[model samples]
Target: MDLANYKNAYLTFALSIQQTRVVSMAAGGALESFPKNLPRAHKDYVVDASAKMSEKLKPVMKGVSGSSFEMEFDLDDGNPYLLPLVGILFTHVAGLGGSPNVDYGGLLKAQEVVMLFAHLEAFLADSIRVICLKEPRVLKKNKKMQWDTILECGSWEGVIDKMVDEYVFEAGWGSIKDKIRNMRSAYGLEIGVSDTVLNALDAAEQLRNVLVHNGGRVSREYLERTGRNDVRVGDMVPLDGSYIEKLSATVTVLGGDVFSAIAVKFFGARPDELRLVFKGAGTVLE
Candidate 1:
């Protein structure tokens, strides 16, 4: 639409915000601040500036939407004055460059473009929150293994010694060894504890010792790294993105049930439901 038409509409809208019975006029209040009946050349200048603003903002909006977040940017409410100022500045620049049509109106429209971008960005953030809440399994399915079997086996020298003595004297080596192996096999897990988990457990144990015996200063970092294999010694900043990514990985390990919601929302099909449509030949899980 033409700049005048848009201006009129905007003025009406702004007035509607305040009171309807007064027949609000854009030529007054904030509107009175601008030139009347803006020249086409001036409108064109603003349109171009607006286009530039839109171009700059497009990527931001796209990023937010893709990430499942919701955000909103309203130029009218957030920074109405600044937006027009930009248009006016651009117009002055164009005029200085010998362009007669250049004016602040174009700069004002640029504000709209920025506002549109912020609004969409906010919307994307909001969407991510909604999607996340809908898929609590994102966190639930990614269960942390409480203990490393291999590590436990390796470190529990005293326990193993006692058990071995009992087995040798009472249970017999053949039967006891076979029983242990069988138990491990049944759980589909190795009896040999994982080195990673073991390391984490050791760190945790050390932290516990320090805190209890030495009065070590407790911090969030200490708690996080205490029993962790990849623990770093220092404060840790909260990384929501990393947390979500980790959650996704954990869910994937737990049969990736969290992705079902993503598929349903994005592709309009549940994982299992899509499988049926794809047929028996398709791989259901990666």
Candidate 2:
């Protein structure tokens, strides 16, 4: 991770975070009240139309159960019902009269938090691959590969690439702590993440797990991992916009910290050099 490589990696990570933030903002905006500042008459007409559409959808809605349903479409024969049904559902749900039927804003925020963590995990894994590729000695103690797998490689670089891929794949995306420990033990890269960032990342990881595995319901595992005693095991995890913003900021800071640490430790980057690189890359480190 020389100055060039460090700049490239940090900028790439920053760009990815920006891209995710843009998408999250767009989704959040879409979840807001539609047709803002509409006249009263138009609002009344929209609400009336929605009521009528709901009535018409009664038969189709009756068949829908348990939060979702599956429908098959034949490509050869154009589906006549899809667009009209979508329009009705969209109008009905987008708050033609008042608030949406469901808390789509909260759901979208939760989803954004989950996606942020996913991007962080991908960056961590990619960092590992980049480091191992640069210094094969870091993987000297890596697990031995099968003879057939090695034989399948056309060249030594391919074998090394495959070996690195397997090594990272086997490591698995555990908790932030687990990932840090794996990096230290496997690649000897000590990523010095701050307590603030570490706690936030751990909490975000637990939240993501609960949302994905436990239907966003707080569990004892999440409480223990996050050290959060305010909410009981059965309570729903709080995923408000403010919390999501905090998590997003934490992710950006942690990414910068990790990248800088690797550059300094492995590539002999100085403090001044790191700062200059970050500045040149238009990355403001808080």
Candidate 3:
């Protein structure tokens, strides 16, 4: 079931949060200053220094988020899930590198969070297949496994492995949303926390598509997809560190709860992974 790997993914992501905080504080300073009272210097030299710092910070945040993201998505190599959550941290890093206006880099980082969420959804979809789809004991003339079962589970065990793999590769499934809905419905799985998580992901997707495919320029497609009609085309997304942290926390809780619910439902009990200290998520040293 690779359940251990899934739990570890969240742990890895949670620990990465500390790295983000550390890197960000180092870049922006530790004092709590309100923007309203902060210095409003418009000098070119001051701006240059911010950008220069960003360049230095970008790599550290990227490395942290990227490794965590990989922990989830790198299924075959067992590295980690597709980590995504260091962008808002990087804007300042990019600033330190001397390009004071680091919003462009921030936009790019926000876009990465979107991609990471999408990949995580796919990972969950694959995991659900193990619980929702089961192989029939013997071949009957009238009985054939459902399409999703074949597609989701390609030869985890016996003779059908090769056949199932070919079918999954060839067939088409809709979005990750479609797959999640179907799996839950088929198995009557309880996903009390998924709705909130999905909302965050949906928002991420809307922003992601724009930042990734449209040069950070808002468009009609983005407005329609996100249902954010207050702005017009070419408007850059407003992403910040706090918002990114909110998204990360939402996804983290969702994964933990959803995994627990599905595991208990499918196996009639939680796996031994319940012993793993899930405590490390969102914790950091001062």
Candidate 4:
């Protein structure tokens, strides 16, 4: 197989790695803080002005009820701070004090990570394009010219060019599912990114779309799209730092795995060029 032909796609795969790394590094500090730096309610919940004098009672100095709110975050791991942070923000927003419920910094960081993956998905499209072309199942050019479609001056080579061009270029080149399907059909390549990664990508797409289109309120459509049984309509989806970190890491690793898999299948070994640049290895090929 001629490696030079696929060099452009390989470069794109490498560039995707660099871009994701930069984003991940920039987000590293933000994730380390996780819930510690995230918003937290005062240990003693404050009461409204009407309840100020009554609130001073020994039994109820600040809060009226201990279990006024409850929240659960189903993530890759159980974080002690996750529920507390959510409670604090929810209480603040629900009118415990005034206006400090929303963690703007954390939200922005999450959005950035989501954007990073969105861009990565596009880059995956480019990688898939090259992988399809290099597939052994792909047929050579056909120069069959139609009765009147072919011009008198055009050679049968032109027909071959058209066939190759249309076949090569007409693969559904946008959607992630489309790219994955093409790889599978052409050569049975399976892009085995984890369920966590897929779920995160799904969440990111929903969050991004909601924020951009509906001002960040989790709509029924968002709920339907995410399919997270726990999340309800009208719930606010916080862009948690930890969630973003997991997503970024998963996608980056998955991209490398995909690159390595493609190289191994096509070349019967890890390509020297891929190793020199992408250093991609350990793609579970079947």
Evaluate all candidate structures by whole-model CA lDDT and list the values in order: 0.35, 0.69, 0.51, 0.54
In lDDT terms, how accurate is model 1? 0.35
lDDT of 1 by residue, 108-226 (tens): 33332233223322322232333333433322333233355435556655434433333333322222224334324532323342345334334433443334443433455556555
Please, what are the lDDT tens digits per residue for candidate 2 over residues 103-150? 657778877877887877877877777687778776677367788888
RMSD of each: 26.1, 6.7, 14.0, 13.0
lDDT of 3 by residue, 110-135 (tens): 64456456545644644544442343
Q: What is the lDDT of residue 92 in candidate 2?
A: 55
All candidates: TM-score: 0.20, 0.72, 0.53, 0.51
Which candidate number maximizes TM-score? 2
Task: Provide the lowest-lDDT 10-residue window in model 2.
Answer: 277-286
Runs of candidate 1 with Cα error greater than 4 angstroms are: 1-102, 139-286
Model 2: residues >4 Å from true position, as ranges? 1-6, 34-100, 181-192, 270-273, 276-286
TM-score of 3: 0.53
